[model samples]
Target: MSATTYDRLVEIVTKLHDAPEDRISPDVTFAQLDVDSLTMVEISMRIERELDVHIDDNELEADLTLDATTKLIDAKLAA
Candidate 1:
Protein backbone atom coordinates (compact mmCIF):
# COMPACT_ATOMS: atom_id res chain seq x y z
CA MET A 1 0.00 0.00 0.00
CA SER A 2 1.05 3.57 -0.49
CA ALA A 3 2.16 5.65 2.48
CA THR A 4 -0.94 7.84 2.14
CA THR A 5 -3.18 4.81 2.39
CA TYR A 6 -1.37 3.62 5.50
CA ASP A 7 -1.63 7.07 6.95
CA ARG A 8 -5.34 7.15 6.27
CA LEU A 9 -5.77 3.84 8.06
CA VAL A 10 -3.90 5.14 11.06
CA GLU A 11 -6.07 8.24 11.10
CA ILE A 12 -9.27 6.22 10.94
CA VAL A 13 -8.09 3.78 13.59
CA THR A 14 -7.07 6.59 15.87
CA LYS A 15 -10.47 8.19 15.46
CA LEU A 16 -12.25 4.94 16.25
CA HIS A 17 -10.03 4.03 19.19
CA ASP A 18 -10.05 7.58 20.55
CA ALA A 19 -6.28 7.30 20.89
CA PRO A 20 -3.36 9.30 19.69
CA GLU A 21 -2.41 8.84 16.03
CA ASP A 22 1.11 7.81 17.00
CA ARG A 23 -0.24 5.10 19.31
CA ILE A 24 -1.54 3.07 16.37
CA SER A 25 0.93 0.92 14.45
CA PRO A 26 0.85 -1.72 11.74
CA ASP A 27 1.85 -4.43 14.22
CA VAL A 28 -0.72 -3.49 16.82
CA THR A 29 -3.90 -5.54 17.11
CA PHE A 30 -7.38 -4.03 17.39
CA ALA A 31 -8.00 -6.08 20.51
CA GLN A 32 -4.95 -4.51 22.11
CA LEU A 33 -6.52 -1.14 21.34
CA ASP A 34 -9.56 -2.26 23.37
CA VAL A 35 -11.87 -1.99 20.36
CA ASP A 36 -15.06 -3.98 20.78
CA SER A 37 -17.19 -5.65 18.10
CA LEU A 38 -19.71 -2.83 18.08
CA THR A 39 -16.95 -0.31 17.69
CA MET A 40 -15.53 -2.32 14.84
CA VAL A 41 -18.91 -2.31 13.16
CA GLU A 42 -19.21 1.40 13.68
CA ILE A 43 -15.76 1.94 12.26
CA SER A 44 -16.65 -0.14 9.23
CA MET A 45 -19.77 1.89 8.70
CA ARG A 46 -17.84 5.09 9.00
CA ILE A 47 -15.30 3.90 6.48
CA GLU A 48 -18.05 2.97 4.08
CA ARG A 49 -19.72 6.30 4.51
CA GLU A 50 -16.56 8.35 4.35
CA LEU A 51 -14.60 6.38 1.76
CA ASP A 52 -17.56 5.08 -0.27
CA VAL A 53 -16.31 1.54 0.05
CA HIS A 54 -18.02 -1.55 1.34
CA ILE A 55 -16.17 -3.72 3.84
CA ASP A 56 -17.82 -6.87 5.02
CA ASP A 57 -17.41 -8.63 8.36
CA ASN A 58 -15.22 -11.43 6.99
CA GLU A 59 -12.82 -8.95 5.45
CA LEU A 60 -12.68 -7.05 8.71
CA GLU A 61 -12.02 -10.29 10.60
CA ALA A 62 -9.30 -11.29 8.17
CA ASP A 63 -7.59 -7.93 8.23
CA LEU A 64 -6.97 -7.33 11.92
CA THR A 65 -3.74 -5.40 11.67
CA LEU A 66 -3.39 -1.80 10.56
CA ASP A 67 -1.25 -2.69 7.54
CA ALA A 68 -3.74 -5.26 6.36
CA THR A 69 -6.60 -2.88 6.87
CA THR A 70 -4.80 -0.22 4.86
CA LYS A 71 -4.17 -2.68 2.07
CA LEU A 72 -7.83 -3.65 2.05
CA ILE A 73 -8.84 -0.02 1.78
CA ASP A 74 -6.33 0.54 -1.00
CA ALA A 75 -7.68 -2.45 -2.89
CA LYS A 76 -11.23 -1.18 -2.54
CA LEU A 77 -10.19 2.24 -3.73
CA ALA A 78 -8.43 0.76 -6.68
CA ALA A 79 -11.42 -1.37 -7.54
Candidate 2:
Protein backbone atom coordinates (compact mmCIF):
# COMPACT_ATOMS: atom_id res chain seq x y z
CA MET A 1 0.00 0.00 0.00
CA SER A 2 1.96 2.96 1.29
CA ALA A 3 5.60 3.52 0.49
CA THR A 4 6.33 3.61 4.21
CA THR A 5 5.08 0.06 4.65
CA TYR A 6 6.97 -1.09 1.59
CA ASP A 7 10.11 0.55 2.90
CA ARG A 8 9.69 -1.08 6.29
CA LEU A 9 9.17 -4.48 4.69
CA VAL A 10 12.29 -3.95 2.62
CA GLU A 11 14.21 -2.95 5.73
CA ILE A 12 13.03 -6.06 7.60
CA VAL A 13 13.76 -8.32 4.65
CA THR A 14 17.20 -6.80 4.27
CA LYS A 15 17.88 -7.33 7.96
CA LEU A 16 16.78 -10.95 7.77
CA HIS A 17 18.70 -11.71 4.58
CA ASP A 18 21.69 -9.48 5.18
CA ALA A 19 21.13 -8.10 1.70
CA PRO A 20 20.94 -4.67 0.21
CA GLU A 21 17.57 -2.98 0.48
CA ASP A 22 17.18 -2.86 -3.29
CA ARG A 23 17.43 -6.64 -3.50
CA ILE A 24 14.28 -7.13 -1.44
CA SER A 25 10.92 -6.95 -3.15
CA PRO A 26 7.23 -7.39 -2.55
CA ASP A 27 7.11 -10.51 -4.73
CA VAL A 28 9.94 -12.25 -2.91
CA THR A 29 9.01 -15.15 -0.64
CA PHE A 30 10.43 -15.76 2.83
CA ALA A 31 11.79 -19.09 1.62
CA GLN A 32 13.51 -17.34 -1.26
CA LEU A 33 15.21 -15.13 1.27
CA ASP A 34 16.60 -18.27 2.92
CA VAL A 35 14.65 -17.57 6.06
CA ASP A 36 13.84 -20.58 8.22
CA SER A 37 11.02 -21.10 10.72
CA LEU A 38 13.01 -19.90 13.70
CA THR A 39 14.15 -16.84 11.78
CA MET A 40 10.58 -16.11 10.82
CA VAL A 41 9.60 -16.32 14.47
CA GLU A 42 12.38 -13.90 15.30
CA ILE A 43 11.25 -11.57 12.56
CA SER A 44 7.74 -11.72 13.94
CA MET A 45 8.99 -10.85 17.36
CA ARG A 46 10.95 -7.92 15.97
CA ILE A 47 7.94 -6.72 14.06
CA GLU A 48 5.78 -6.94 17.16
CA ARG A 49 8.33 -4.99 19.12
CA GLU A 50 8.91 -2.36 16.45
CA LEU A 51 5.38 -2.00 15.17
CA ASP A 52 3.48 -2.61 18.38
CA VAL A 53 1.30 -5.26 16.75
CA HIS A 54 0.48 -8.88 17.34
CA ILE A 55 0.58 -11.40 14.52
CA ASP A 56 -1.21 -14.72 14.76
CA ASP A 57 0.36 -17.97 13.61
CA ASN A 58 -2.28 -18.42 10.95
CA GLU A 59 -1.66 -14.99 9.55
CA LEU A 60 2.06 -15.61 9.46
CA GLU A 61 1.51 -18.89 7.63
CA ALA A 62 -0.90 -17.34 5.17
CA ASP A 63 1.23 -14.39 4.13
CA LEU A 64 3.67 -15.70 1.57
CA THR A 65 5.09 -12.53 0.05
CA LEU A 66 6.61 -9.35 1.35
CA ASP A 67 3.67 -7.37 -0.02
CA ALA A 68 1.20 -9.71 1.58
CA THR A 69 3.01 -9.49 4.88
CA THR A 70 3.02 -5.72 4.66
CA LYS A 71 -0.70 -5.76 3.91
CA LEU A 72 -1.38 -8.02 6.85
CA ILE A 73 0.61 -5.79 9.13
CA ASP A 74 -1.19 -2.74 7.80
CA ALA A 75 -4.57 -4.36 8.44
CA LYS A 76 -3.57 -5.30 11.96
CA LEU A 77 -2.29 -1.77 12.57
CA ALA A 78 -5.57 -0.40 11.30
CA ALA A 79 -7.53 -2.64 13.62
Candidate 3:
Protein backbone atom coordinates (compact mmCIF):
# COMPACT_ATOMS: atom_id res chain seq x y z
CA MET A 1 0.00 0.00 0.00
CA SER A 2 1.03 3.56 -0.65
CA ALA A 3 2.47 5.55 2.22
CA THR A 4 -0.09 8.24 1.62
CA THR A 5 -2.96 5.86 2.21
CA TYR A 6 -1.25 4.35 5.22
CA ASP A 7 -0.54 7.76 6.67
CA ARG A 8 -4.11 8.84 6.18
CA LEU A 9 -5.35 5.68 7.84
CA VAL A 10 -3.03 6.31 10.75
CA GLU A 11 -4.29 9.83 11.04
CA ILE A 12 -7.89 8.71 11.02
CA VAL A 13 -7.35 5.95 13.55
CA THR A 14 -5.39 8.16 15.91
CA LYS A 15 -7.96 10.89 15.73
CA LEU A 16 -10.99 8.66 16.09
CA HIS A 17 -9.63 6.30 18.71
CA ASP A 18 -7.53 8.84 20.60
CA ALA A 19 -4.60 6.54 19.99
CA PRO A 20 -1.05 7.75 19.93
CA GLU A 21 0.43 7.99 16.48
CA ASP A 22 3.50 6.08 17.60
CA ARG A 23 1.34 3.17 18.73
CA ILE A 24 -0.28 2.92 15.35
CA SER A 25 1.81 0.73 13.13
CA PRO A 26 0.87 -1.17 10.01
CA ASP A 27 0.99 -4.40 12.00
CA VAL A 28 -1.29 -3.02 14.72
CA THR A 29 -4.72 -4.59 14.83
CA PHE A 30 -7.98 -2.73 15.51
CA ALA A 31 -8.45 -4.65 18.75
CA GLN A 32 -4.95 -3.71 19.81
CA LEU A 33 -5.81 -0.10 19.06
CA ASP A 34 -8.86 -0.44 21.33
CA VAL A 35 -11.19 0.39 18.48
CA ASP A 36 -14.71 -0.81 19.19
CA SER A 37 -17.54 -1.46 16.74
CA LEU A 38 -18.88 2.08 17.04
CA THR A 39 -15.46 3.52 16.38
CA MET A 40 -15.06 1.18 13.45
CA VAL A 41 -18.21 2.61 11.93
CA GLU A 42 -16.89 6.10 12.43
CA ILE A 43 -13.60 5.11 10.87
CA SER A 44 -15.36 3.61 7.91
CA MET A 45 -17.43 6.76 7.45
CA ARG A 46 -14.40 8.98 7.78
CA ILE A 47 -12.47 6.93 5.22
CA GLU A 48 -15.33 7.21 2.78
CA ARG A 49 -15.80 10.91 3.39
CA GLU A 50 -12.13 11.82 3.39
CA LEU A 51 -10.78 9.35 0.85
CA ASP A 52 -13.88 9.06 -1.31
CA VAL A 53 -13.68 5.30 -1.17
CA HIS A 54 -16.36 2.89 -0.12
CA ILE A 55 -15.39 -0.02 2.12
CA ASP A 56 -18.08 -2.49 3.05
CA ASP A 57 -18.66 -3.19 6.74
CA ASN A 58 -18.05 -6.88 6.14
CA GLU A 59 -14.55 -6.01 5.02
CA LEU A 60 -13.68 -4.55 8.41
CA GLU A 61 -12.91 -6.74 11.40
CA ALA A 62 -11.39 -6.32 14.84
CA ASP A 63 -8.56 -8.66 13.89
CA LEU A 64 -7.63 -6.58 10.86
CA THR A 65 -4.27 -4.86 10.97
CA LEU A 66 -3.57 -1.35 9.78
CA ASP A 67 -1.65 -2.84 6.87
CA ALA A 68 -4.55 -5.06 5.91
CA THR A 69 -6.96 -2.14 5.95
CA THR A 70 -4.54 -0.07 3.98
CA LYS A 71 -4.22 -2.84 1.42
CA LEU A 72 -8.00 -3.15 1.27
CA ILE A 73 -8.36 0.56 0.72
CA ASP A 74 -5.67 0.46 -1.92
CA ALA A 75 -7.40 -2.41 -3.67
CA LYS A 76 -10.70 -0.54 -3.63
CA LEU A 77 -9.02 2.57 -4.98
CA ALA A 78 -7.37 0.51 -7.65
CA ALA A 79 -10.66 -1.06 -8.66
Candidate 4:
Protein backbone atom coordinates (compact mmCIF):
# COMPACT_ATOMS: atom_id res chain seq x y z
CA MET A 1 0.00 0.00 0.00
CA SER A 2 1.16 3.51 -0.74
CA ALA A 3 1.25 5.46 2.47
CA THR A 4 1.55 8.72 0.60
CA THR A 5 -1.54 7.98 -1.42
CA TYR A 6 -3.43 6.91 1.65
CA ASP A 7 -2.27 9.97 3.54
CA ARG A 8 -3.24 12.28 0.72
CA LEU A 9 -6.71 10.74 0.59
CA VAL A 10 -7.09 11.02 4.34
CA GLU A 11 -6.05 14.66 4.13
CA ILE A 12 -8.61 15.38 1.48
CA VAL A 13 -11.35 13.44 3.17
CA THR A 14 -10.68 15.07 6.52
CA LYS A 15 -10.85 18.49 4.96
CA LEU A 16 -14.08 17.75 3.15
CA HIS A 17 -15.57 16.00 6.14
CA ASP A 18 -14.75 19.00 8.34
CA ALA A 19 -13.47 16.55 10.85
CA PRO A 20 -10.19 15.62 12.41
CA GLU A 21 -7.75 13.38 10.57
CA ASP A 22 -7.76 10.94 13.44
CA ARG A 23 -11.45 10.36 12.94
CA ILE A 24 -10.89 8.67 9.60
CA SER A 25 -9.71 5.12 9.19
CA PRO A 26 -9.20 2.70 6.35
CA ASP A 27 -12.23 0.67 7.36
CA VAL A 28 -14.53 3.62 7.93
CA THR A 29 -17.06 4.42 5.21
CA PHE A 30 -18.42 7.80 4.18
CA ALA A 31 -21.95 6.78 5.12
CA GLN A 32 -20.68 6.03 8.57
CA LEU A 33 -19.55 9.62 8.81
CA ASP A 34 -22.92 10.97 7.73
CA VAL A 35 -21.59 12.14 4.37
CA ASP A 36 -24.51 12.61 2.03
CA SER A 37 -24.48 11.80 -1.66
CA LEU A 38 -23.87 15.41 -2.64
CA THR A 39 -20.81 15.70 -0.47
CA MET A 40 -19.62 12.39 -1.82
CA VAL A 41 -19.78 13.82 -5.33
CA GLU A 42 -17.83 16.84 -4.21
CA ILE A 43 -15.27 14.63 -2.61
CA SER A 44 -15.02 12.57 -5.79
CA MET A 45 -14.44 15.72 -7.81
CA ARG A 46 -11.81 16.92 -5.42
CA ILE A 47 -10.13 13.56 -5.48
CA GLU A 48 -10.00 13.56 -9.26
CA ARG A 49 -8.56 17.08 -9.37
CA GLU A 50 -6.12 16.51 -6.57
CA LEU A 51 -5.04 13.00 -7.47
CA ASP A 52 -5.30 13.30 -11.23
CA VAL A 53 -7.40 10.18 -11.41
CA HIS A 54 -10.76 9.30 -12.90
CA ILE A 55 -13.23 7.93 -10.38
CA ASP A 56 -16.82 7.64 -11.40
CA ASP A 57 -19.69 8.29 -9.02
CA ASN A 58 -20.80 4.68 -9.10
CA GLU A 59 -17.38 3.36 -8.11
CA LEU A 60 -17.15 5.88 -5.29
CA GLU A 61 -20.63 5.12 -4.07
CA ALA A 62 -19.84 1.44 -4.17
CA ASP A 63 -17.03 1.68 -1.65
CA LEU A 64 -16.55 4.73 0.48
CA THR A 65 -13.79 3.42 2.68
CA LEU A 66 -10.16 4.52 2.75
CA ASP A 67 -8.88 1.01 2.10
CA ALA A 68 -11.31 0.15 -0.67
CA THR A 69 -11.10 3.53 -2.35
CA THR A 70 -7.34 3.44 -2.23
CA LYS A 71 -7.43 0.05 -3.86
CA LEU A 72 -9.72 1.44 -6.52
CA ILE A 73 -7.28 4.23 -7.15
CA ASP A 74 -4.46 1.77 -7.40
CA ALA A 75 -6.45 -0.29 -9.85
CA LYS A 76 -7.15 2.79 -11.93
CA LEU A 77 -3.51 3.69 -11.88
CA ALA A 78 -2.62 0.19 -12.90
CA ALA A 79 -5.05 0.33 -15.78
Candidate 5:
Protein backbone atom coordinates (compact mmCIF):
# COMPACT_ATOMS: atom_id res chain seq x y z
CA MET A 1 0.00 0.00 0.00
CA SER A 2 0.99 3.56 -0.55
CA ALA A 3 2.50 5.36 2.40
CA THR A 4 0.48 8.45 1.53
CA THR A 5 -2.75 6.51 1.67
CA TYR A 6 -1.76 4.80 4.91
CA ASP A 7 -0.80 8.11 6.49
CA ARG A 8 -4.08 9.75 5.55
CA LEU A 9 -6.09 6.81 6.85
CA VAL A 10 -4.20 6.91 10.12
CA GLU A 11 -4.88 10.63 10.43
CA ILE A 12 -8.59 10.23 9.79
CA VAL A 13 -9.00 7.27 12.13
CA THR A 14 -7.01 8.85 14.93
CA LYS A 15 -8.90 12.14 14.72
CA LEU A 16 -12.35 10.58 14.48
CA HIS A 17 -11.76 8.07 17.27
CA ASP A 18 -9.80 10.45 19.47
CA ALA A 19 -7.00 7.90 19.42
CA PRO A 20 -3.39 8.72 19.90
CA GLU A 21 -1.46 8.72 16.64
CA ASP A 22 1.24 6.62 18.21
CA ARG A 23 -1.26 3.90 19.05
CA ILE A 24 -2.31 3.44 15.46
CA SER A 25 -0.24 1.44 12.99
CA PRO A 26 -0.57 -0.35 9.66
CA ASP A 27 -1.05 -3.71 11.34
CA VAL A 28 -3.53 -2.55 13.96
CA THR A 29 -7.17 -3.44 13.42
CA PHE A 30 -10.15 -1.22 14.14
CA ALA A 31 -11.43 -3.69 16.71
CA GLN A 32 -8.15 -3.45 18.53
CA LEU A 33 -8.64 0.30 18.59
CA ASP A 34 -12.09 -0.11 20.12
CA VAL A 35 -13.87 1.37 17.12
CA ASP A 36 -17.58 0.65 17.29
CA SER A 37 -20.15 0.30 14.52
CA LEU A 38 -21.14 3.95 14.69
CA THR A 39 -17.54 4.96 14.50
CA MET A 40 -17.04 2.72 11.50
CA VAL A 41 -19.81 4.50 9.67
CA GLU A 42 -18.34 7.81 10.66
CA ILE A 43 -14.97 6.69 9.42
CA SER A 44 -16.45 5.66 6.10
CA MET A 45 -18.17 9.00 5.68
CA ARG A 46 -15.05 10.87 6.63
CA ILE A 47 -13.02 8.87 4.15
CA GLU A 48 -15.47 9.68 1.39
CA ARG A 49 -15.53 13.33 2.29
CA GLU A 50 -11.82 13.74 2.81
CA LEU A 51 -10.44 11.27 0.32
CA ASP A 52 -13.11 11.59 -2.35
CA VAL A 53 -13.67 7.87 -2.29
CA HIS A 54 -16.95 6.22 -1.47
CA ILE A 55 -16.71 3.22 0.82
CA ASP A 56 -20.01 1.52 1.51
CA ASP A 57 -20.76 0.97 5.18
CA ASN A 58 -20.87 -2.76 4.56
CA GLU A 59 -17.38 -2.61 3.19
CA LEU A 60 -15.87 -1.44 6.44
CA GLU A 61 -14.82 -4.33 8.60
CA ALA A 62 -13.80 -3.97 12.21
CA ASP A 63 -11.19 -6.66 11.81
CA LEU A 64 -9.45 -4.84 8.97
CA THR A 65 -6.10 -3.27 9.68
CA LEU A 66 -5.01 0.18 8.52
CA ASP A 67 -2.88 -1.44 5.82
CA ALA A 68 -5.81 -3.44 4.54
CA THR A 69 -8.05 -0.40 4.64
CA THR A 70 -5.51 1.55 2.67
CA LYS A 71 -5.40 -1.15 0.04
CA LEU A 72 -9.17 -1.07 -0.23
CA ILE A 73 -9.14 2.68 -0.66
CA ASP A 74 -6.42 2.40 -3.27
CA ALA A 75 -8.47 -0.11 -5.19
CA LYS A 76 -11.55 2.10 -5.03
CA LEU A 77 -9.59 5.11 -6.17
CA ALA A 78 -8.16 3.12 -9.02
CA ALA A 79 -11.58 1.93 -10.08
Candidate 6:
Protein backbone atom coordinates (compact mmCIF):
# COMPACT_ATOMS: atom_id res chain seq x y z
CA MET A 1 0.00 0.00 0.00
CA SER A 2 2.96 2.29 -0.30
CA ALA A 3 2.10 5.68 -1.76
CA THR A 4 -1.57 4.68 -1.78
CA THR A 5 -4.39 6.42 0.06
CA TYR A 6 -4.46 3.70 2.70
CA ASP A 7 -0.78 4.10 3.38
CA ARG A 8 -1.05 7.86 3.49
CA LEU A 9 -3.88 7.78 5.96
CA VAL A 10 -2.10 5.33 8.19
CA GLU A 11 1.08 7.35 8.02
CA ILE A 12 -0.73 10.55 8.93
CA VAL A 13 -2.38 9.06 11.98
CA THR A 14 0.73 7.28 13.09
CA LYS A 15 2.71 10.45 12.80
CA LEU A 16 0.25 12.40 14.90
CA HIS A 17 -0.10 9.74 17.54
CA ASP A 18 3.49 8.53 17.49
CA ALA A 19 2.12 5.02 17.11
CA PRO A 20 3.19 2.30 14.82
CA GLU A 21 1.23 1.96 11.62
CA ASP A 22 0.55 -1.68 12.24
CA ARG A 23 -0.88 -0.79 15.64
CA ILE A 24 -3.31 1.43 13.78
CA SER A 25 -5.06 -1.10 11.61
CA PRO A 26 -7.78 -0.14 9.19
CA ASP A 27 -10.66 -0.50 11.65
CA VAL A 28 -9.04 1.52 14.44
CA THR A 29 -11.08 4.60 15.29
CA PHE A 30 -9.79 8.08 16.08
CA ALA A 31 -11.37 7.82 19.50
CA GLN A 32 -9.11 4.87 20.17
CA LEU A 33 -6.18 7.15 19.55
CA ASP A 34 -7.48 9.93 21.81
CA VAL A 35 -7.81 12.29 18.89
CA ASP A 36 -9.26 15.61 19.98
CA SER A 37 -11.53 17.96 18.08
CA LEU A 38 -8.71 20.34 17.31
CA THR A 39 -6.53 17.54 16.06
CA MET A 40 -9.32 16.36 13.82
CA VAL A 41 -9.49 19.81 12.29
CA GLU A 42 -5.75 19.74 11.73
CA ILE A 43 -5.98 16.33 10.17
CA SER A 44 -8.79 17.45 7.90
CA MET A 45 -6.73 20.37 6.71
CA ARG A 46 -3.65 18.26 6.22
CA ILE A 47 -5.53 15.72 4.13
CA GLU A 48 -6.88 18.43 1.88
CA ARG A 49 -3.54 20.19 1.52
CA GLU A 50 -1.52 17.02 1.08
CA LEU A 51 -3.92 15.16 -1.17
CA ASP A 52 -5.43 18.16 -2.94
CA VAL A 53 -8.85 16.78 -2.17
CA HIS A 54 -11.66 18.96 -0.90
CA ILE A 55 -12.81 16.81 1.95
CA ASP A 56 -15.70 18.21 3.90
CA ASP A 57 -14.94 19.00 7.54
CA ASN A 58 -18.00 16.94 8.38
CA GLU A 59 -16.05 13.89 7.32
CA LEU A 60 -14.41 13.96 10.73
CA GLU A 61 -17.82 13.67 12.39
CA ALA A 62 -18.27 10.28 10.80
CA ASP A 63 -15.98 7.31 11.19
CA LEU A 64 -12.47 8.66 11.69
CA THR A 65 -10.75 5.42 11.01
CA LEU A 66 -7.73 5.27 8.74
CA ASP A 67 -9.51 2.86 6.44
CA ALA A 68 -12.64 4.98 6.25
CA THR A 69 -10.62 8.12 5.53
CA THR A 70 -8.67 6.27 2.88
CA LYS A 71 -11.90 5.21 1.25
CA LEU A 72 -13.25 8.72 1.37
CA ILE A 73 -10.07 10.14 -0.13
CA ASP A 74 -10.00 7.49 -2.85
CA ALA A 75 -13.64 8.11 -3.73
CA LYS A 76 -13.00 11.83 -3.91
CA LEU A 77 -9.96 11.28 -6.07
CA ALA A 78 -11.93 9.00 -8.37
CA ALA A 79 -14.61 11.63 -8.70
List where candidate 3 sits over 4 angstroms from the true fold: 1-3
lDDT on C-alpha atoms for all candidate structures: 0.77, 0.74, 0.91, 0.80, 0.91, 0.76
lDDT of 6 by residue, 17-70 (tens): 666555678888888777887878877887888889877777775357778888
Which candidate would rank higher by lDDT, 2 or 6? 6
Residue pair clashes in candidate 5: none
Q: What's the C-alpha lDDT at position 41 in model 2?
A: 80
Per-candidate TM vs. native? 0.79, 0.80, 0.92, 0.85, 0.90, 0.83
Location of the lowest summed lDDT over 10 successive residues in candidate 4: 14-23
Q: lDDT score, residue 3, model 6?
A: 94
lDDT per residue for candidate 4 within 30-77, as digits (tens), equals 877777888788888988999889988788873468888888887887
Per-residue lDDT for 1-79 in model 3, tens only? 5559999998888888988777888899999988999999999999999998998898889999999999999999999
Residue-level lDDT of model 2, residues 20-74, one tens digit each, is: 5555678877777677787788778777887788887666752388888988899
The Cα error of candidate 6 at residue 22, in Å, is 5.1
Give the per-residue lDDT of model 5 (tens digit) for 6-46. Answer: 88998889888977767788899999999999999999999
Instruction: Using lDDT as the measure, name the better of candidate 2 and candidate 4.
Output: 4
**Model 1 agreement with the true structure over 5-37: per-residue lDDT tens digits:** 777667676777786656678877777677888
Clashes in model 4: which pairs? none
Ranking by lDDT: 3, 5, 4, 1, 6, 2
* Worst window of 10 by summed lDDT in candidate 6: 14-23
State residue 55's C-alpha deviation in candidate 6, in Å.
1.5
Which stretches in model 2 have alpha-carbon errors above 4 Å? 1-3, 20-22
lDDT, residue 79, model 2? 92
